[model samples]
Target: MDLQQMRYVVAVAETRNFTRAAERCFVVQSSLSHRIAGLERELGVRLFARSSRRVDLTDAGAAFLVGARECLAAADRAVADAAAATGVVRGRLAVGVIVTTAAVDVPELLQRYRARHPDVHVVLRPGHSAELAAAIRNGDLDIAFLGLPESERPSGVESVVLDHDKHVLVVQAEHRLAGASQVALREITEETFVDFAHGSPGRAQSDEAFAAAGLVREVAYEAGAGELMTRLIARGLGVALLPSAFIRPLAADNPELALVPVVDGPRRIEWLAWSRFNPSPATRAMLDVLGVVRHA
Candidate 1:
């Protein structure tokens, strides 16, 4: 019946608990429950299947939530646009990032963005490139910073190329390849490897390089983060393929880890992706700060 009631239903649905939902919405549990109860009575339908342990949305509630979310998004956009017209950019800016990338210093960049637009709410979601790109297409993220292989480009969204770099081999101090100045991918075929999860953008480059050379290397470990991958290599668990720019900052801190140039290495491409349909003013400002002259 009201936007506030719809918000309560949404919060309860997402959290699946009245207490947590109330906490998230900054309301008392009793007030939130009373509000939803009134809404259910007004709509002539039970919105939730309540229990002692958890709460689940009824079929009607599920249907209602879809419209509720859309209405909320539209309302937010209206408010944001009105503010933009007054030369004040005030809105939520959800950003997705590929963790451990060296294409651009994200913290410093965001610091500048925050300084300029203090009214905007900035949310950071660190994830894999593919996941970030999907979020951009889904309108879950206002913008994203992605790193994919040179052989591939992000599809389904407008994006710009920011940087290009190559991969390097990471090994333990005592590993056979550690003493070598540089080595070919073929020479390390027998060595166990550590890499990003299969089918991931980060994994694709390493996978493609070996596939192109008609060789199969065993990736004994899958690391979600660069620090974890370097740690695994330091323990002699497996050698890894890392970005060239990332090696310098990591080598001193991880003394047990050594970097060896790969004669034939996979190339990385960094991209900045934004929504093709109505990017927020905050998103545009952030891109402007990044020197993104125009959308792709």
Candidate 2:
């Protein structure tokens, strides 16, 4: 019946727990439950099947959730439109950035954006590419920078390619192939490899390259951060296929690591993505600052 009630329903449906939903909505559990129950009574339909352990949406609840989300989004758009009509680009902008070596100098970009829009409040969230993409799709984030495979980009979002990141083979300087300017996937097929964790775009690209060459590589270690992986390689743990931008700076600082171009490796494209639905004025201002125009 009310926007707040619709928000409570959608939050509960998404989280599947009353307490967690209440926490996200910044309300007490008892209050959220009472309001939802009141809403159910008003509609003469049970929205949720609640138990101690879990909260499950009823059939009617599932049907109502879709419209509830649309209504909330529209309401938010109306508020944003009103703010925009006032000609004030002042609002909270939630931004997500994957923790990786960025080609675009993100800190500088943020500094410039802040300088231009002094009234806008910016909140930065660091996360993995997949997690950030999910947050953007869920409307938790206004925009995110993600390293995504061109073929596997999520739907219902608009994206602009910020950088094309290439992968290179890195090894200890004393390794057999350290002096080589370029190497192929087949050349390192039998070597011990240090790779990023499974499900990461870097790891996926490395796997795809080996698979394309009909090669099976032995992964001796897996690390989440490029710095950790580089450390493992510097200790002669194993060779790794890492983003060129990530290892290049390390290679300059540490003479122990050598980076060689991968002659036939997949390039990971870093994209700045946002929801295709109505975006706030602050979000649009950010896109403009970044020189990205969303397509219709």
Which numbered prediction scores highest in TM-score against the true structure? 1
Could you give candidate 1's per-residue lDDT for residues 1-296 as a string of tens digits? 88898889999999999999999999999999999999999999999998887799999999999999988888888898899898888889999988757888989998999888899999999999999989999889989889988888989999989888889898998888788989998999999998988999889989999999999999889988988888888898999888888676888787798889998988899888998887888888898888888634
Model 1 residue runs over 4 Å out of place are none
lDDT of each: 0.89, 0.85
**Which pairs in model 1 have colliding backbones?**
none
User: Across residues 1-296, which tens digit of lDDT does each residue of candidate 2 receive?
Assistant: 89999999999999999999999999999999999999999999999998879889999999999999889877866776787798767777899887674767888988989988887888999877888878888988999988865466655678877778788888999999999988888888889988877887767877887877888999989887778888899999999987787678778999999988988875788888898877888899899899886776
* Number of backbone clashes in candidate 1: 0
Q: How many residue pairs clash in model 2?
A: 0
Which residue pairs collide in model 2, if any? none
Best-fitting candidate, scored by lDDT: 1
How many pairs of residues collide in each model? 0, 0
